[model samples]
Target: MPENTERDWVLPTEIPFSELKGKDLEECVYWLLDAMGAKDLEWRIGGAGGGAADGGRDLEAHFFEPDEEGELRPQRWWVECKGRSGTVESQEVKEACNNALAYEGIDRLIIATNTQFSNPTRDWVKEWQRTFSRPRVQLWDRAHLERYLSRHP
Candidate 1:
């Protein structure tokens, strides 16, 4: 056998999703988005062991889209990371939606969770999209996140 010169890379699929919790999960989300070319990403946590005081957005990012004049307009994205073992419920989604409303200039709100989303929550998101005109809501549950990681990696 030839001498091993290449470094081994562990894909996200090899890691146990349940093992990622709280801050770790949030950081993972940041990395995933960063790999996908999102800019101005920042974790909500300020000091050591501190969380967002507002409990709204866990991460913030911006994606630029060229306007009619060829000016890159920023689309603000607010990402909320949830690392719960159980399925994410409608109440949690509702709270995120409510909190996102308070944030001005946000173009989209993304709820990123390591767990599955409840059917009701999915339906609620659909209804919310129909009712709301601004700040589109999106869900990035386990399957969705895995798909993104697979594509980006």
Candidate 2:
């Protein structure tokens, strides 16, 4: 059978910037994952989701691909989602990179933000790309968010 039920994508311009905080951030990440065609994955809200703390790493999700033997491996990924919170700090990106190391074997580390990172943070990311560039870390800022929304709309 051929699959022909393709849906058009649309960018949402109505999502208030204020609503992308905390729990809303997790939901938005979840929606993005779904839109990206990820299925049967487990995700949880850490840090603040457990109550009150530093509200670190708002949300985390995993995406896996089968190995050569058809075994589902941890060759997955970890996502750190942050809402529009002014400019993200270099330490924040550093934290996500550190977390990815703790996860080991992850194919990628994705930091999705509804905002932009400061100059220092951007430089930090660039340096990361230059050093220990194993678990490819991708920084998705506001522009990426807008594109995702539009493509899935």
Candidate 3:
């Protein structure tokens, strides 16, 4: 079992969508992102009330590398947050992966969903892991979520 922190790994039963908008989702995502040790990160929580454009990615974090401009440029780290009760479908995962591929200089794509991915989606992830050498896209389901939350909270 994953460790429990000040804030436990909440299911949809604990916190519904009505509660997880804006600051609530942002706080959760921030904890996970920090636990992941993401540097130079920027996040937008719960692609609702407007910010769902530029693909379905919830957070657009750019890990910077020194460029010729002598300034840190955004590297690809398009994060899609699915804080839903239902298991994520394969099509959504595919769409996020495709978006990551389309973005310039994205080193990786992270799909962070509160629920598990469908079996087909898990298989698809395995295939992508084998196929993609650079700019790989990976899935992080509720287990990962709980682990991170446990560490932080």
Candidate 4:
């Protein structure tokens, strides 16, 4: 694992995303998010092998901000991890998005994938955001994850 220090920072070359499985991939995503300042993290999808019955939520984090009363309130964010190889198509993205939207109490939904997303899937997320009032959606594909690690490390 790479540390946050600049001198210690090294982009992964040995362990490709395609090689990671189950908890390994989820832990990578969790640490990445933690490095990016996400707090109150919870791993909903554990290391135990399971299917997509997790309601499109793999992890949860809280972002604190002051409300109208000037008291800090936690804005819940749900994360869904797709660590498969090849590009994630529009249908897959739509399914994840729908599952996230259907779940309650989340202020934002983040889809983190080792594989890249299709152009149509990206466009669909943009349009979906335009139509919804809450629970904003964000996609973190391979390139995005790389960039984030580079910047934060």
Off by over 4 Å in 1: 1-4, 46-55, 67-71
lDDT of 2 by residue, 1-153 (tens): 988998854446666655676668667777887777665545665554434342334444456678899998654556677776687767778977876676556677778877787877777778877887778888887778777877875
My TM-score estimates for the predictions, one after another, are 0.87, 0.73, 0.67, 0.79
lDDT, ranked from best to worst = 1, 4, 2, 3
Predicted candidate 4 versus true structure: per-residue lDDT over 57-92, tens digit per residue:
888999887889999988998888777778876787
lDDT of 2 at 38: 64
Worst 10 residues of 1 by lDDT: 46-55
Better of 3 and 4 by TM-score: 4
lDDT of each: 0.85, 0.69, 0.67, 0.79
Supply the global lDDT for candidate 4. Answer: 0.79
Q: Point to the candidate with the largest TM-score.
A: 1
Higher-ranked by lDDT: 2 or 3: 2
Rank order (by TM-score, best first) = 1, 4, 2, 3
Residue 127 local lDDT, model 4: 90
**What is the model-wide C-alpha lDDT for candidate 3?**
0.67
**Tens digit per residue, CA lDDT, model 1, 1-153:** 999799877676775889777888888889988998899988887555645473588889899988899999999989888888899877889988987887689899999998899888899889887888668998998888888888876
Model 3: runs farther than 4 Å from truth? 1-23, 45-51, 54-56, 62-76
**Mind sharing the TM-score for model 1?**
0.87
